[model samples]
Structure formats: structure tokens, C-alpha cells
Target chain A: MIEVAGLTKRFGPTLAVSDVSFEVQKGEVLGFLGPNGAGKTTTMRVITGYLSPSEGRVRVAGYDVVEEPLEAKRRTGYLPEAPPVYPDMTVVEYLAFVARIKGVPRREIQTRIEEVSEKCAVTDVTDRQIGKLSKGYRQRVGLAQALIHNPEVLILDEPTAGLDPKQIIETRELIRGLAGQHTIVLSTHILPEVSKTCERVLVINQGKIVASGTPQELTHRLQGYETVLLTAEGPAAEMMERLQRVSGVNLVEPRDAADSRVTFEVHAEKGHDVRAELARAIVESRWKLLELKTSGLSLEDIFLQLTTKDLGEGPDTSDKSSVVGIV
Target chain B: MRNVIAVAGKELRAYFHSPIAYLVMTVYAALLGFFFYSFTATYVVQSFRIQAMGGGMGAPPMSLNEYIIRPLLAGVLTVVILLLVPLITMRLYAEEKRSGTIELLLTSPLTDLEVILGKFLGAMALYAVLVAMTFLYVGYLFLHGNPNAKPLLAQVLGLLLYGAALLALGMWFSTFTKNQIVAGVVAFAVFLLLFVMDWVTAYGSGRASDVISYLSLTKHFDNFAKGVIDLSDVVFYVSVVVLGIFLTARSVDALKGRA
Candidate 1:
């Protein structure tokens, strides 16, 4: 229900978003995965009609964001990075105000507020001033305001940020519950939030889309060939040569050798699993097989490889670097 | 229209919930009350002295409208509103910008004109309430003495237009920055400049001075205070109000780009 084409936003000297293009279909949940300053929020702002694109155009529900902003905005709900709330207003008052501006019918306003507050789990604090609530509740109130109008398109930026682990899980479940009803484009740095909640993922870096696919598709695409680690008691050079000759094996390199025991990393061609054949050959050749396991790339590795590898640097190999810190 | 009312209603509620409105009202009531009592006391003393002298030197008696009500409403209240209006309008948009609520408002379906007009109307409503409080003194004068209601009504209309123009100007400045202190100070400075435009023209009466006097905010109120509602003066106040609202709308639109 949303189409953003050639959107470029220039803030004086820095280009916050440049030539970005993407489309989100109706009832599809698209996860926007990017590190901080990856133009995720900028793109969201453009789509929500908060910021006009310096170039190109955005259309929401078939209405141009710049030309027909009111119509476009009427059909879209946006939760900015910071929940835009008045500290002095109570939860119910704030939601009612949002509903009013969102063009929710007056007669249905009360029911709509109740429904969203229930959905977002903010009903308990309806009478309390928003400033008095905890961060989790305040964030839920923010979500409640966004959903108050029941807009067809929902754009949320970092919906789970700053929440406790339990709150994060609850929010993820809430967003998942919204699937197939509202077209959603949620930007987040958390990896599992995407894997657990999104149907498709778009990885953006440095104001450009680096990768776009399903979670499984991204992992499989990044794993161009299957890798198997084999530990055996054999001469390193001969074993490496014999392992390469095995069917479906593309490359065999000796990883380490100590006395008679050596380990070889076998890379099988894409779409091939030659573990059974390689194990039989190793046994038939009279080499003592100590360990053999298939190693497939995880989404974390794929995300790192796609975002950071293109910077002319291999993935950082430190213990802390193994975690997905960027996206 | 509903969008405008929605925004305006929220803003009006915000003003009432905060202590600033009450604080301004108290200070205004005390100052205006003191001015009214003192001006009437001075008028009464002069009247008694004239009666004691048996209408000495053929001096005509001073009308309460000329000597007391006109100065109280036009002179003293103008200054009171000058000091209080910035306080009323400083947070209209600046608070939204500081707290990041501008995002929600801008992203909503409301147009820039609707948002600006809503804020304008909200600020006007508060100013109206504050100005309305002074009418109690007017009501007392009507009950105790013979006072012409025509000029009184004219002055009330004049003050409404005058105060609205100032409120709109203050609202426009509030939209230019996220700092309320800056907005208030700059709005006061601009209001002060416009307030003194007539005085500045006193030094000379050239074409430039004539233009300055014509542009003076206080200049147009003089005719209304005298119970003469000239269309030009009405048009002038309306023009300023329109100018202020238009600039504020443009500023709100500008905020989206800066966002």
C-alpha cells in the first residue's frame, strides 16, 4: 500500500537518504534492518509525510505524499523514534486527541480508544498522566495512539527499543498479531525481532539497500557454498587432495595438523550436501575420522557480510564482534 | 474544520491545565483593578472640586468615558496584554517542537493552515477570557453610574481585535524556534517595537514618520476608543491578524523540511 521512489533527503551538507526506492504491499510486514544512521528513520519520516523528500516522490494508498499529503496521511499511522506525546495529558486524552486528528469518527472514538488501549496493553494507566508512566507504558501509549485510527498502513520506528526483555517479547507478539491486517514497515536494529515478526526483510546501509529477502533467503544467498569441517588422522596434503576429488566437493583446505591428526575444511558446491559420501570415503580410506559437522552461515553472519564486508574489511573476529551489534 | 477544532481544543486544554494562564490572569486582574480604582478616584476628586467651585471658569465636566474607561481599557490594558500575551503564546509551538510532538501533529491529516488557525484560535480564546475579566469593572460602572454602552462595546471590540493581532504575532514567533524563552523574548521585542512605533514618529512628521505612525499597533485603537469604528482601522487590525496567521502557517510548513 506504500510506494517510495527515488527518495533523497538532503540536510544541508549531509544526504540523510539518497535515491532510496521500495514498495510495501497490503498486509505485508516488512522489516527494515539497518544500523544507526542508515536512513531508516529518514525513509519512515518521508513515507509518513513528516518530511518532504528533497527529490522523487512517495505515495501512500494511491495518494502522493507531497501533493495530497492530507489524504496520504489520513491512511497512514506513524510512531516516530521518540513517542510524540504531551506529558501533561492522560493516556485516554492523548489517544482521543490522536484519534480526532486521525479523522476517526466522533461516535466511534470511545470504542476505538478502548480497542487500541486493549491491544497495546495500556488500559490500566488510562487515567494517569502520561509523564507519570514508565517507559514501557509510555511506549505502549505511543503505539496505542498510532493504532487509534485503524489506519491501513502502520510505520513504526524501533518499536521495541528501550523496553525490558519481557516487554520486548510482548511488543513483538503484539506486532505479530497485527499481521495480515495492516501493512507494516517497522525499522529496528534487533535481528530476532525481524526473524520472529517479519515476513520479509530489507537490509539498508549508508542510505542504500544492501540486501532484500526473507530471513532464510538471506542466509542461503550469503552461503554460496556449503562448508563441512572434518577432523581426521592423515597426512595434510594427501588428505586435502583426496577430499577435493570427492563428488560435489569444490575446495578442500587443511585447517590444522598436529602429529597424525589433521583437520580439513571441505567446501561443497552450492545446493549439494556431500557429508555422507565424504564420510564413507574417509572411512574407506582407513583414516580415523574424529569430527565431522556441516557448518551453514547464520543470518547474523550474512548481515555482517552484506553490510560490513563491502567496506573492504573482513568481519571483525573479536569475541564481542561475533554479536550482531550493527543490525 | 474538525481538525482545526481538535488541535485548538487540545491547546486550549493545555493552557488551562498549566499554571501560566492562572498566573497571568491574577497579575492582570490585580493591575487592572488598581488602575481602574486609581483613575476613578482621580476622576471623582476632580468632579467634587469642580462642583465645589460651582463650575468655575466655565470648564465642561470630564466624561467618565473620556477620562477613566478609555484610558483604563485602551492604555493600561494594552500594556497589560503586551506583557502577558507572550506568556500565553510562547508554548503554542515551541513546546511541541522541544518535546517532539510536532512530529505527531505534522504527520496527522491536518493541514498547515488548520494547525496554525487552531493554535491561533486557542491563544485567542485565552486572551479573550483574560480580557473578559476586566468587563466586571465595566459592569460595575454601568450599575453605579451613567456610562454609554456604545463606546464601551466599541472599546471591547477594539481590544479584541488588537489583542488578537498581538497574539497572532506572538504565535508566529513561537513557531520560529523550539526555545520558549527565545520565542517569548523575541515576541516581546517585536511587540515592543510595534508598540513604540507611534512614539518614534513624534520626533518628525515626514512621509516615513507618517508610515511608521500608520503602522503603529496603538494608532488604530484610538478611533475605536473614541467610539468611532472607522473601516480603515478595522481593516488594519484584520490585516495584521491575517499577516500573522499566514506567516505562522508558512513557518509550520517550513518545520517539515527541517525535520
Candidate 2:
């Protein structure tokens, strides 16, 4: 329920977001991945009507943010990178103040506050001063304030930053549960956050979106260049020769071994799955299979591959391939 | 309007929660009490003695303010009124920016006016409390001697007008910086300059001195304290309030990037 077109933001001479465009459909949890300073927060600000885009338009729930600010704001909830908080106000008071400012119906404000607090699980500390809250609780309070009005579109900037591992996991689950009721656009540098929490991923580099697709599609596209390792109780020389004989096996080489068990690493031809063929050959050779390892690329690998500048350019782009070289 | 009141209520509550309000109250009561006892009370006792000696007292010292109090105390109320006003007003938009809570407030459906008026009215309510306590001196002034009701009315009105001007100036200063210290210092500086303008103009050998004195807040506010309903003085305070509120709204818009 959100649309952004030709969106650009310039802070003086610096272009923070450049010609960015994307849509998050109703009920879709879109993960926005970018390195630090990649313009994600700028984009989120533009969409939320907090910062008017230097050019183009952003519409949320059918209302253009610039042309109809209040209506657009009425339909959207946004949590900026810093959990906007007043240290002197307690959590309940803070939520109530936010509810009133956000134009929630006066009569329903208390109920709305309770609803969001329960949903974000910030109810227990509703009476505590926000400044006294731990980082995680403060964050949950921020989420509660954003969701108090139950806006249709939610734009969260790094919703799970600076938390212990368990808290991070819990926050992700909470965001995931918010899907379907609220169209979400969440930005983070965490790769697995995208894989676990987003149905579709949008990879941003510098100030531009470099790629967008399902997680499986990204991995499948990069699967063209992959390899497998197979160790078996067979002659290294003959096993390597036979594996090379199999169609779609591109390269074969011996790996260090123990006793009669020898190892060989094999590269597959483009679009090839050589597992069945390799297994068949080992059974025929009467070679006892000791170990078979397939190169299963993690989301980190996919992120590195797409974010790696050289691979994106077919090696003609600037060398950010060191990103890929690591891990 | 709901947003404004909501904000105003919170700000009023904030004043009580912080010790600064109590501190301002203590200082305000002490200074006003000094003026009440030394000037208003002595004037009333003398007027009564003069009337006892068969002389006609001016207007029979009707309200507690007549013999002992004048609207000028109300005008100078702007001085101490200003002391507390800037500390809170400086934090209006400045604290929000410093704490990054401006994003939360502005990003909501609240309009700029709501934010501005809410904060203004909130500060006004606290100033109202300070003004309320100062009235106790008026009560005491009326108890012993005849006091004029009319001048007392003018003084109360003058207190409000002075408050409106200073509050506006203070709120406007708040918009200039994110640092509360800077905001408070700058606001205090602006008032200090205005407070000293008449003196500087008196010393210098140019019509510029006359011009500075004319622009000085003290000059515009002087008529109010003297029980004179000068429209120009009213206009001047109104202008100050408008200017302060206008600049504050613009600042919030600029920071919100809607400007």
C-alpha cells in the first residue's frame, strides 16, 4: 500500500537518496538491505512524509504524501532509527501524547494505547519513565507509539538494531507478525534479517537499488558458479577420472585424504546438479562414500555477491569484490 | 485544538514535575513580595494616614494595588516572568531537536500550529500559576488600606500582555538552536539587550538612541503598567507574540523539511 517514484533527496550538495522507486504491496514484508549511508533512512523518511522528497512523489494508502500530508500520515506509521522519545515522560504518558498528536479519536485514545502496548509487548512497563528503560524496552515503546493508531503502512528504520541476540530474534518475530495487517518496509544491514523476515529483498548500494527479488531467486541466479566436495574409499586417481567423465562436471581435483579414503572437489557446469550422478558413480565403483559436501550458499554469500560491485558489472565495475572475497 | 490542549496539558504538568518551576515560583514570590511590602503597602499606609489628617487621598485607595501596587510591577513582572519563561520556552523546540523527539511529534498528524500553540499555551499556563501566586500580595495590600480597583485591573491585563510578548520572544529563540544552553543564553541575551537599550540610547549622541529606546520592550510595555490602554503598546506586544509564534512555526517546518 505504498508507492514511491523517482524519489530523490538532497541535503545541500550531498544526494542522500537518488532517483529511488519501489512499492510495498498490502501484507508484503519488504526487507530493505543497504550498507551504512546507503540512503535507506532517507528513503523511509521521504515515504513517511517526514521529509518531502526533493523530486517526485510518494503515496501511502492511496494518499500522496506531499499533496495530502495529513491523510498520508493518517495511514502510515514510522519509527525512525533513533527511537524518538522524551526522557521525562513515562511510557503510558508518552504513548497517550503520541496518540493525541497522531489524531487518534479522543475517546479511543486509551484503548488504542493499550492495544499497541500489548501488541508491541510494552504493557508491563507502561508506568516506567522511558529514560529508565533498557534499550530493548525503549525500542518496544517506540514501536508501540508508532503502532498505536494502527496505521495501514509501517516504515521501520533498523527495527532491530543494538540488541542482544535473543532480543533481536524476538523483535524480528514481532515484525513478522505485523505482516498482512500492515504493509512493512524495514531496512537493515543484517543479511539474515532479510532472509528470515522478508518475502522479497531489495538490495541497495550507494544510493541506488541494485537488485530486488525473492531470496530463492537471488540464490538460484548465483548458483550458476558453484562446486561440491566428495570423499570416498576409492582410488583418487580413478575416481577423479570417472567424475570428470560425467556430463556437467566442469573440473575435478584431488583433496587431502586419510588411509584408503580419498577426497575430490568437483565444480559443476552451469545450471547443473551433479549429486545424483556422483552418487550413482560411487555406488557402481563399489567405493564406500565417506563424505559428500555441497556448496550451500548462505544469505551472506548472496548479499556479498549482489553487493560486490565487480560481479554486478560483469567485472567492468569498480572492485568491491573484496566484500565477496571475505567469507 | 485537541493536539494543542494535549500538548499544553503535558507541558503544564512538565513544569510542576521539574524543580525549575518551583524555583521560579520562589524567586518570583520573593521579589514581588518585596515590591508589595516596600512600595504598595507603604503607599497605602501613608495614604490612610494622610486621609486621617483630613487630606483627600487619591481615589480613596480602593483595591490593594492602588496605593501600594501599580501596573508597572506587572510590567516588570515580565522581567522575572522572563527568567522562568526562557528556561522552559528554550526547551520547547530545542529539547525536541536535541532529544530527536521532534521527529516523533512532527511526523504524527499534528500540524505545525498545534505544536506551536500547544507549547505556547502550555508555557502560558505555568506563567499563569506564577501570576496567580503574586496575587496574594494584592490580597494583603487591599486588606489594610483602601485600594483602587481600576489600576489593579490594568496591571493584571498588563501582566498578560507582557507575558505574551516575552513568551513569544522566548519561544522564537528556542527555534534558533538545538542546544538548550545556547537557546536559553541567546534568549536571555535578546532580553538583556532590550532591557539595556533605553540606557544605551540615553548615553549615545544619535537619533539611533531614540530609535533603540522606542524598539525596546521596556518602552512599549511601560504604558501598560501605568494603567494606560495605549493601543500602540497593545499592538507592540501583539506583534512580538505574533513574530515569536511565526518564527517558531517556521523553524519547526524547516527542521521537519516541510518548508
Candidate 3:
């Protein structure tokens, strides 16, 4: 229900968001994964009609955000990085004000407030002033404000930034429950949040969309070769040599050895599964197999690799060619 | 219109929820009351002195409107409003920008005009309340003295318009910065300049001198103080009010681009 095309936002001479384009379909939960200062908030602000794009255009629910801002804004709900709340007002009072501005009918405002308060789990603090609430409650209140209008599109910038672990889980569950009814575009620096709650992920860095895919696809696409970790109580030098002889085994690197126990990272050719062959080879060699597991690239490693490549810093061991395909 | 009211209602609530509304009202009432007492005492003393002269000399008649209500509304209240209006209008946009609530208003479906007008009206409402307190003192005059109700009404109208023009200008200054203190200081400085702008006419006489005196905020109120509602005075205050609101709308619009 949202489309951003060639959206470039410039603050003075510095570009906050540059030539970025993405689409989120109806009822689809898209995770905007980026480290801090990755233009995630800037892009969301453009989509929500808070900040006009310096170049290009953004449309929400078929209304151009720049040309028909009121219509676009009517259908979009935004929760900025800092919750846009009046600290002096009570939670209920704040929600009621948001409901009014969002154009909820007078009679329906009460019901809508109660519904969102319950959904965001902020029902208990309804009567208390927002300034007195805990950070977690305030964040939830922000979430409730965004959901008050029940808009078709929800743009949340760092929705789970300040919540405790339990509160974070509850918020994720709440967002997951909102999937089919509302199109959500939530930005976060937390990698696991994307894998747990989002159907698709857009990884952004330095005002650019670095990568976009499902959690599994991102991992698989970035890792061009299969890798296996085998730990055995044997001589480290001999085990590395034996594993290197297995068919399809492209390379083997020893990781750690202590008290005659050894760890080896075995690399296999693409599309090859060398686990069975390596296991059989270890058994025939009379070495006791302690642990054997295939190790695919996790999202964390992929994120670090993707974000660190541009900085020309961090570990650069991965083949650069494999990453160029996804971008 | 509904959106405007909603924003204005929120602005009003913000003012009341904080200590600003009560503090300003109490301080303004105290100052105005003190001025009223001193002005009334002086008027009473002057009347007695004029009567003691036995109406023989060519001394002018001591009218209550001329001696008390005119200066109270036109001079004392104008200065009082000058001192207090920045307190009311400084927080209109500055606090919203400071606390990040501007995002909520800007991203909402409401137009920039609606938000600006709502804040304008909200500040005007509080100013009205401050002006309304003078009625408590003014009402007392009717019971004891034969003050001209026509001049009193005219002066009150003039005070509201005068305060409205300043409030609008203060609100416009508030849109420039996120710091309320800075907004208040700048607004007060500009108001002081406008208040004293006519003073420059004493030094020279030319087209520039006439323009400066005409632009002086207090000069236009002189007509209303004399019980005459000059159309030119009305138009001047209205123009300033409109200009202030228009500039505020543009500032808020530019904020979106820079935000």
C-alpha cells in the first residue's frame, strides 16, 4: 500500500536519504533493518508525510504524499523515533487528542481508544499522566497513538527501541498480530527482530538500500559455499588433512585445539553436502566424533558483512563477488 | 474547522495542565489590580483638588473616563500586555518543537493553516481571559461612578486587538526556534522596539519618521483610547495580525522541508 520512488532527502548539503525506492504490499510486514544513521528514520518520515523529499516522490494508498498530503496522511499512521506525546496529559487524554486529529468520529473515539490501549497493552496506565509512566509504557503509548486511527499503513521508526526484553517480546507479538489487518513498515537496528516478526526485510545503510530479501534468502544468498564445523578428540594436524581429502571438500581450516581436542571449519563446493562424507571419513580413521554441525551464515554475519563493506573496515574475508549479486 | 478546534483544544489543555496559565493569570491580575488602585487613587485626589478650586479657573472638568479608564486601558494595560503576552505565546510552537510533538501535528491530516490558527486562537483565548479579569475592576467603577460605557467598551476592544497583534507576532517568533526562552526574549525585544518606535519621531520629521510612528503598535490605539474607533486603526491591527499569522504559516511550512 506504499510506494517510494527515487526518494532522495537532503538536509542542507548532507543527503539523509538518497535515491531510495521500495514498496510494501497490503498486509505485508516489512522490516527496515539498519544500523544507526542508516536513513531508516528519514525514509519513514518521508513516507509518513512528516518530511518532504528533496527529490522524487512517495505515495501512500495511491495518494501522492507531496501532492495530496492530507489524503496520504489520512491513511498513514506514524510513530516517530521519540514518541510524540504530551507528558503532562494523561494516557487517555493523549490518545483522545490523537484520535481527534486523526479524524475518528466523536462517538467512536472512546471505543477506539480502549481498543488500541488494550492492543498495545497500555490499558492500565490510561488515567495516569504520561510523564509518570515508565519508558516501556511510554513506548507502548506511542504505539497506541499510531494505532488509534486504525490507518491502513503504519510507519514506525524504531518501535521497539526502549522496551525491556519481555516488553520487546510482547510488542513483537502485538505487531505480528497486526500483520493481516494493517500494512506495517517498522525500522530497527536489531537483527533478530527482523527474522522473528517480519515477512521480508530491507537492509539499509548510509542512505542506501544495501540488501532486500527474506531472512533465509539473505543468509543463503550471501554465503556462496557450504561450511561445516567438526569437533573431534584427535590430533589437530591430522584431522584437518583427513577432512580435506573428502570429496567436494574445497578447503579446511583449523579453529581451536585444547588437550588433544580439535575444531575444524570445513568448506565444501557450492551445492555440496560433505557432512556424510566427512563423518564417514572420521569414523574410518578411528577418531572419536565429538560434534558435527553444518554452519550456514547467520543473519548477524550477513548484516555485518553487508554494512561493513562500504566502510572498508571489519573482517573482509568473504568473497566480494557473492555480495554484489544481492545489491 | 474541526481539526482547528481539536488543535486549539489541545493547545488550551497544554497551557492549563502546566503552571503557565495559573502563574500568568495571577501575576497579571496582581499587576493590573495594583495599577487600578493607584490610578483610581490619583483620579480621586485630582478630582478633589479640581473641586477645591471652585470651578473658577479654566481647569478642565475631571471626567472619570478621561482620568481613570482611558489611561488604565490604553497605557497601563498596554504595557501590562506587552510584559505578559510573550509568556503566553512563546510556548505555542517552541514547546511543541522542543518536545517533538510537532511531528504528531505535522504528520496528521490537518493543514498547516489549521494548526497555526488553532494555536493563534488558543493563545488569544488565554489573553482574553487575562483581559477579562480587568472587567472585575472595571465593573466596580460602574456601581460607584458614572464612567462612559462607550469609551470603556472601545478601549477594551482596542486592548484585545493590540494584544492580538502582539500575540500573533510572538507566535511567529516562537516558530523560529525550539528554545522557548529565546523565543520569549526575542519577542519581548521586538515588542519593546514596536512600543518605542514612535519615540523616534521626536528626533526628526520626514516620510521615514511618519512611517515609523505609524508602525508603532501603541500609536494606533490612541484613537480607541479617545473613544473613537477609527477604521484606519482597526485596519492596521488587523493587518499586523494577518501578517503575523501568514509568516507563521510559512515558517511552519519551511520546517517540514528542514526537519
Candidate 4:
């Protein structure tokens, strides 16, 4: 439903998005995962025909955004980072105005407004001034306006940014319900939101695509450098020495020692399991193994690892393994 | 177009919903009313003096339409509009930018011309309301004295065109900045400069003076106040309106290159 090919945007000297290419199939929900200033909004703006790409082309519903902006815009609905709403107008007035400008059938505008207001759960605030509503309600009104015309594609930038926990869950469910009918590209910095909502994720960093896959695939790919925590009854120095001798153990350091019970954090080599080896070694050495904990890299770890690293080293390369670090 | 009408309707509703519209209307009506009463009193006093000198038998009476009403409607009304029209036009685009609503407007399917024309029509409609209130005073004149409808129509037409040209110019300046105060101030400065071009003509007598005098909005409006609907004057105001509209369109188009 949407195709962005080699898209690049430059604001004076800063390259907001650089030679980025991506595609969304019909009825697929693609999560744009990136930190702030990662060019996600810029790419979305280009796809929606709000901003022309400085270099390449963007097509929505088979219409080139630059050449046929009106046709492309007609099929796409965009909610910018900030909800573009007028405070003085009531929710119904704002929605009606949007419906008119978006070319909804004159006779069907009222019904369309009712349907979207219901879907977004903003019906009660339809008569209330938008300026007086809470932030959550205003956001729902923003969503209502976007869906008023029933566009085929929805481009939402950080849709659940400022909502409370309950509103966030409600909005997430609302977006999830919208899948399979409207192709969606939603950008977010919230990690769990993507894991629950999106079918596929594209991790972007420093104006480049660092990784792209299912949430499970991303976690599994970065699971090679999982860390382990061990508690043993022995001298701290002796435990560190013995744990370092285990095969696949890259680094070991004592965390703390109390009553001769020492805690150690063990860093293992990629794709290596040193837990069993260390446990057996401690038992043979007369040291009691009190507690052993091993954990795979979480999505938060993967996100921080992907974005905090500098570009031009290995993250920007197409090789997936090169992007992995001390996750 | 339907899109244009939709935008225009929204903008017009916005004007009435805010306090600025009523404020401008009240202030405008009060000023015009004071000027109308003073001009009529001065005309009535002058007529009495002329009659007392001639013994009041067959002395010719002064024409109120040419002497008082025309200047009040054409000259004073135009200046008042030039000062107040910014309140109507300043928020046309500037408020949208400040409030981040321009994103919604530009991303919609409507074209730039539709948005510009719709806003222009909205501002003109509000100005019409302000101008219509003065008709109450005009009606009072018709009840008491006989006046020529031809010059009256000419004055009304001239003021409409003059006000439109000013509104268009104000819209153009509003397109340049997101700050409404800056837009209003700059619009005022530009209109004042254009209004004073006739004085520049007095300082020189060459081709420069001719161009300055031609560019003076007051010079063209003077012809209309004198009961002459010259084609040249009509063309000048129309050209100004067209120029303002295109400049506004260009300002909006520049956003694409910078976006």
C-alpha cells in the first residue's frame, strides 16, 4: 500500500532521512522503531505528501506522492507529532470541517463523523470545546478526524505519546482493531507498545535501517550476548578465578560478598552457555551454588544497543550480526 | 469549488466565534458614526451660512453627497479599513502555523489556491459585515435629505475594492510569519507606505513621480469618490488584488521547497 524508495530529506545542512527504502504490504501493520530524531517523522511526512522528498520518490496506493499529491493524499490519513487541532472549535465542528475538506460525500459526512467518533471513543466530547478537553480526549479527536474519510492508509506519528495508562491501552487496542483493513505505519519510542501491536518492526538509527524483523526475531537475534548472574558460597577472589576458567566465559567480576557468599556477574561469549559449566565447576571445588540466573536480551536492551552506537562502524551495514553489541 | 467553500465557511465561523470580530465591529461602527455625524454637522452649518448671506430666496444649496458623504465613505472609510483589516487577515495563515494546524491544512486534498481563495473570501465577508453596519447611517440620510444613488453606488463599489485590496495585502504578509503580532505590524507598515505614495509624488516630478502617483491607492480611490468609475482605476485595484493573491500563493508554495 505504501512504498518509499531511496527517500532522502535535507533541512539545510542536516540530512533528516538518507537514502532510506521500505515497503508496506496491503493491510500490514508496520512499526517504525526509532529513538527521537531518527527521521521517522520525516519519512512519514514524505509518504503522506506533506513534504516532498529531496532525493527519491514515495508512492501511496500506486500514486507518486510528488507527481500526484492530491490522489496520494486522498487515500492517506496523517496524524502529525502534535495533534493538529484548533482549540476554539468543538470536536464535532472540527470533524465536520475535516470531513468536508477530505471530500467525504456530502450526505454521508454526518454518519461518517458519528462512526469515527464512536470508534475513537470521543462521542461524549463531540459538543465540548476541544481546548477544554483533556489531552487524551484531544488525541482521540485527532484520531477521529484522521479516520473521518475512511482513507486506505494511516500514517500516525507517536499516536500514544501523552495518554494515561488506560487511554494508552484503549488506543493500542483501537489501532490493533484497525489492522487488516487500513495499512498502518506507526512510529513510537515505546518498546512494549510495538511488541504488542505491530506484526513487524523496522528498527531505524542515525537515518539508516539497522534491523528489521518480527519482535521475536529481533530478541532472538540479539540473544547471543545474554548475561548471567551467579551467587556462590566461596571467597570472592577464588570464585572469580574459578569462573574465569570455564569455557565460553569471556569476563567475570565479583559483585559483592557477604558472610562468604559472593555474587558474580558473568559475561559469556556469543551463543555460549557457561551456566552449566560454572555450576559443575563450583560443585567440584566444594563451593555451594546458591543461586544461578541467566536472561536473554530484552527488547529494551536491543533498542538501547542499536540506537546508542555510532554510525559508519557496523550498525549501518546490511549484515545483521555486525549490528549486535554487548546487549 | 466545494473545498474552497468548506474552508471559507470554517474561517467565517471562526471569526464570529472569537472576540476579535465583535471588537473590530464595535470599534469600527463607533468611529464611522462619529465621522458621519461630524461631517453632516459641518455640511449643515456651511449651508446655513450661505443661505444667510443670500437672503434665502433662490440661492443654490450645497450637494451633501459630493461635499460630505463621499469623503466620509471613500476616504475616511478606506483609511479606517486599512488600519483594522489586519485584525481579520493576520490570523488567516499565521494562527494556523502557530497552532500547528497548517500541517492538517496542507496535507489535506485541497490545493493551495483553494485555501488562499477561501481565506480571502472569509476575510472579505467579515469586512462586508463591518461595512454594512454603516448603512444604518446612510439610511438616516435618505430619510431626511435627497441624495444621488449613482455616486452612492460608486462610493460603495470603490470601498469594497479598496478594502479587498487591503485584505489581500494583509493576507500576503500573514503568509510570511507565524507570529500574528509581527504579521499585523508588517501589514500595517506596508499599507501605510502604499497609502503615502502620493506624498512621494509631490517630492519629485519625473518618471519616478509618475510611477509613485500611479501606485498610490489613494489616487485611484479619489476618482471613485468624485463619482467617476474610470476603467483605469478599476483595473489598478483589480491588479493589486491579483498581485496580492499570487504573492500569497507563492509564499505558501515556498513551504514545499523548505519542508
lDDT of 3 by residue, A98-126 (tens): 99999999999999999999998898889
lDDT of 2: 0.80
DockQ leaderboard ranking: 4, 3, 1, 2
Residues A1-327 of candidate 1: C-alpha lDDT, one tens digit per residue: 999889899888899988888889999999999889989999999999988899988999999999999999999989988899999999999999999989999999999999999999998899999999999999999999888889899999999999999999999999999989999999998888888989999898788887787888777656667889999987677777778889999778787889999988888887898998888888888888899999877777676766675575644332223323323
Total clashing pairs for each candidate: 0, 9, 0, 0
Please give the C-alpha DockQ score of model 4. Answer: 0.77
Model 2 per-residue lDDT tens digits across residues A1-327: 888889888888888888888888899999899888989988898888778888878989999988888898988888888899887789999998888888888899989988888888988899999999999999999898889889899889999999889989989999999998999999999988899999988888677787777877666655655578898997778888888998898788787878888888888875788988998898898888878888766767666656666336442132233222221
Per-residue C-alpha lDDT of model 3 across residues B149-179, encoded as one tens digit per residue: 9988889899999999999999999999999
Please write out the lDDT profile of model 4 over residues A133-198, one tens digit for every residue.
999998889988889999999999999998999999999999999999899999999999999999
Interface RMSD of the candidates, in order = 1.6, 2.2, 1.4, 1.3
lDDT of 2 by residue, B1-259 (tens): 7888988988887778777688778888888877666775566587678788876745543444534566436545767766776776778778888887878876788788888898899988888888788668777656755567676776677777778788888988888788988988888888877776788776686778778887888787667677777888888888889988998887767775633
- Identify the superior model by TM-score, candidate 1 or candidate 3: 3
Candidate 3: regions farther than 4 A off: A232-254, A257-262, A276-289, A314-320, A325-327, B53-61
lDDT of 2 at B141: 53
Per-residue C-alpha lDDT of model 4 across residues B1-259, encoded as one tens digit per residue = 9999999898999999898799899889888999998999998888888787776668557887977788789868888988898888999999999998898999999899999999999999999998888788887888898888788888888888898899999999999899999999999888888898799778789998998899998899988888889999999999999999999999998877685
Q: How accurate is candidate 1 locally (lDDT)?
A: 0.88
Candidate 1 chain B: worst-modelled 10 consecutive residues by lDDT = B55-64
